[model samples]
Target: MRKEHEEFVDSFEGQLPPSIIAEIKDTCPASVTKEQLKEIVELTLGLYKHCRVNAGECVGLVSAESIGEPGTQMTLNTFHFAGVSEMNVTTGLPRIIEIFDAQKEIKTPMMEIYMKPSHNDLEKVKKFAIKIKEVVFGDFGAEYVLNIFEQSMTIKLNKALLSERGLSSKDLAAAVKVKSKGFNMEVGNDFLTFVHKGKPEEIRQLYDLREKMRPVKIDGLKGITQVLPVKRGDEYIILTLGTNLEAIFEYPEVDISRTMSNDIHEVYNVLGIEAARQAVINEVFKVIESQGLNIDIRHIMLVSDIMCITGAVKGITRYGVVSEKASVLARASFETPIKHLISAALESETDRLTSVVENVMINQPVPLGTGLPGLITKLK
Candidate 1:
């Protein structure tokens, strides 16, 4: 670890998390060249200075205008997997709304899973991706056979397909028994059977059992409906359609430091508020960049800070952080002016007219910058 760099970050009085501190130290280790360390230090200091906001800067107005301007240019097109119309991901404007609104469930919740250094090999990553992909019992069954006389069901496995997916008859049998119980299972070379000795009218149970067993997840991470391993630069990274943050973090082969989910709330819940704040900034910038829009990252950061100021994720919407503004007129300006005015009047809420909007509403000069300095004369 680099002692000077560690001390410099620690000077923030634990404002920075240990993982970030460790990452800095690890990257600029004591063994690294002194010139490199100097460059890193200068970059870190420069970033810190760049992030600091001036006192009386109307950050809210700046952020709103910054993001809102480019947001109007976003397309409403959805990204769908060919041949599977139902597996479309919400992108562009809708995706931005899903993030900033702090919606509990997103249309397409996903994760970019980074593997540990040891598991970065192409074959290893490819196998790992398959292992993490959600596998339902229906994948193994070539044909579902239900005998009316025996009141039993059998899943005839396609030997080639089953073997290709790295599944065996025993695995299929175990999964069927675990998911759909009460029937005695018999595993054979290329088939699995479920026999239930029951009354003739209870044959309806056979159809129900088949339906229940078909969708049962026999293996892989639950909620991760699909996984695509793509090689980026030198290493392989897994892109999953559905997110399972809690479960993915538990795997030892996963590089916890780099593994991040697209769902802001999931990131907030799994990681702390700071991580969530960073996610917001990254996600917003990502969308902007995708549309080839050039906006100052600082504006996005300001918005993120406001959303996470209460130490939890809140949206900029009327029901979220915006509604809790200290100034009543600001809230009113956001949404439902009449409702806000009535509520404020009934509650006897005082508006100090300190902020820009409130002062402008009452035809007073806004107290920002030069306006903040009121002239005073001493009695002669």
Candidate 2:
């Protein structure tokens, strides 16, 4: 762009990418002094070069070892909100593995919900959080009772809860009526009853219905059980204990751009593979940082790259990425050597000895950097 910026960039000997240079240039003021630009350029280049690795670093192995070493030091326990919250979320080492493995159903799925600017006020946020928190019949009901003689189930609702949730008994009855029309419903102040059309002698059917109704999402975002609003720097955000990425976005007041689900697969489903890659990196770093441990971010980035390189998130286990290696020997070397060898032999597979693992297995010099040089010459 500017001669001053262009000259400064040229001083790097073409090591810095054009994108980085353009970004620095664009962000700088038009009237910025050449001396300031020079200092910035040098600092940026120095940092970049410092982060760059040597040609034969064997990044994958180094990253695995680096991350794993720290992982052993991590707490294996999950976190629970102290009694009052009545919720538990998987965190620490287990969570780290779950994120890396891209497990379909996470142990403790969670979400960070950001509200639209207009709806971020405390009152609105609180009300919205309440509206989205999963409310089951058991939660608001003071008591759950079975009437075998009448083939009915009745719940005595807490009046204060109804008032607090801005729901009347009629509203509650209407919701159940819509979902379960097979019941003869009666609505009154602080109580509701349902008489199943099925015979009273069908006791097992009634018990099954009781269990089903315990998790009936009356009104709220499904799966979101607890919501806590936290002040982050200058803004407030809601942290939820459960995740339902698809349903939460339906709310018009949610800041769709910023709200995120901690469940990696959910992120992949909603945002695609690239976003899932970022989530893995962010989540790993988050765990390590929280425990007051600092590891090279490059290692974390490399791990994220490997897991996401397949265009879908897969674990670093035998059933996942390890088994999917192009080299037959490479797969064998990971674990269960005989099984892999036998399976490969049955299929008449060939090991080209292309990768480090396969080459090393055959006692050949692994082809990395200098190992790639096949010919030697006399300097005469």
Candidate 3:
């Protein structure tokens, strides 16, 4: 460990070009010693570790709070799969009901129907269902059955779908969009979509309703919030939160905590590399400035890497030679904790001295030595 620390110090020293070191020494008057440089590096690394760890916790907290809040909804907009076209249908509650109704007649009821170019046509499928109903129970009977499917698509008083249902915008406190397999919809400015699951008539009705309901405008939605607890399985997964300012205000808990977590996560997503780099630089500079020390910027960069390489916050630890080496050097030069203690003591002494001087100015005897004569010979 000692050898490695020596090598680390040597390597760092070697990196600093002689000219820069000389210039710093010349400018600062106190030459940059190997020990001082090491201390600066170690301090820089420590700061980096602290920032990263805090950043992760901050992100996690924000994600949990955003998802736990009330009044969130998730939209899943979908499109057609590959090698398939022409039978395109928008996803909505009404369409799902229609599909469920058409399948109800079949014994299996859970049959998966594959649609080819013409076969996939939603309008054609609806017509086919209508014809099938007509053959079995006549025109009036077919109409009654179709009406049932249509009625199922209606939104109930509790704000849930009456028919083939999924989560609605109102049911959730916020919406989170996760990227899924094969031609999934991108997170966008509108509602989510899913594949049409029912007959043409039902699909059309759902699409119409979706179109009629204006897209929920999410104003000033800073970003998405995601929470993943440390647990087995999928015990707690709060996926996404919408950026609706009004919704957030109505439920401030979600906005402040959960949404903020997501936003911080998003920050990592958007600028992790840059943030990490800047964090290192900032920390190194702070250590150098605070200690009244002079060190090369590149040395500070090295220290930053040591501290932040793990992207975790950490305090100074003995296992790391940088911290240990720096501490030893600082102790050797300044008598471990003594210099600070002495400085504090000196400050108190100075205050006492000032008080004595003020008393003398007022024609009063100073405390102790001030009032007594320096030469007093006692007659034994």
Candidate 4:
């Protein structure tokens, strides 16, 4: 890893106690690869950015939805503090409607709130906002909320320092408050003045206190299965649970008795499907082993079901037919390495048969398969 990346990892690593790290390492068993580590870091940073941008908006939504007249046009903008500072609030009726419509797809609902900051009071306004955010979110057990508030303060400060000479720093600070709330305060004679009325500190504080708790961990895959490759004639195919059966048999053969001897259509027939799926997988492995093919057992188990039964592999769509039951069976059988063994065996058959024999082996789909587009009708 680059020095900066390593530093980031170390810093984040330090957040956990040694006991916790040891426990994680024991349970997960060195499962965090370099790629996964990078992904976790990236995800964390993304969440941080998202939270900074949306925390204030969340407060604004609540405020707008609560106080504004049902049909009235209103725009409210203000800086919010939750340990971290953010510019948030709502916009007019049209903008609110736009936000509502966009929310359905984007999952984020926000509208613009205008703020005109004076020269000097800008810093104070920012500081006050940050303090308010910390107090509010802090009540809800969110320790990191202040980080965004602090960042927002730094941003406003930089802008104030770089603006034109006519805008005094004091004037800038005074402008941070919204005037309609009739809220005012004096920090210093020279620096403190009303630029605009700001939202009540109490209201901001209440909103912060009621904000939802931060999740301890994110949702998604903890890890992914490594892709297993199966050679079929001149090409290779990825062995997944959805692999087709035509990929299996290597030569022309009569319709033979199913290796599995039990009915597998019903959900209660777990033992039957399990038995048959395993038998079919074992047969596939026997075939591949006879051919002296070197491949992973896990891969064979991935597509075991399609190779074993007359049913098309479920989830593995062709052009027309969707194998609902077969797909479900395939998915269920290969939940572990044992079933993965069956899946792997099936894939080997698929590769060998399709490549060498040029025939649809077992459950391989045709144009009549479940994945077909448009209407599929049979002529009498």
lDDT tens digits, residue span 277-320, model 1: 99999998887787788889988888888889999999989989
lDDT comparing candidate 2 with the true structure? 0.81
After superposing candidate 2 on the true structure, give the runs of residues whose Cα lies further than 4 Å from its correct spot: 1-14, 17-51, 79-89, 148-151, 163-190, 196-199, 202-205, 375-380
TM per candidate = 0.72, 0.81, 0.18, 0.15
Across 281-345, the per-residue lDDT of candidate 4 in tens digits comes to: 55445434543444456554645544334442222232112223234233333344355446657
Candidate RMSDs in Å, in order, are: 7.9, 4.9, 25.8, 30.9
The number of residue pairs in model 3 that clash at the backbone is 26
Which scores greater on TM-score, model 2 or model 3?
A: 2
Residue range with the least summed lDDT across 10 consecutive positions in model 1 = 371-380
lDDT of each residue in 97-156, candidate 2, tens digit only: 887777788887889999898987888888888888888866777887888788887889
Name the lDDT value of residue 192 in candidate 1: 83
TM-score of 3: 0.18
List where candidate 4 sits over 4 angstroms from the true fold: 1-271, 287-292, 308-380
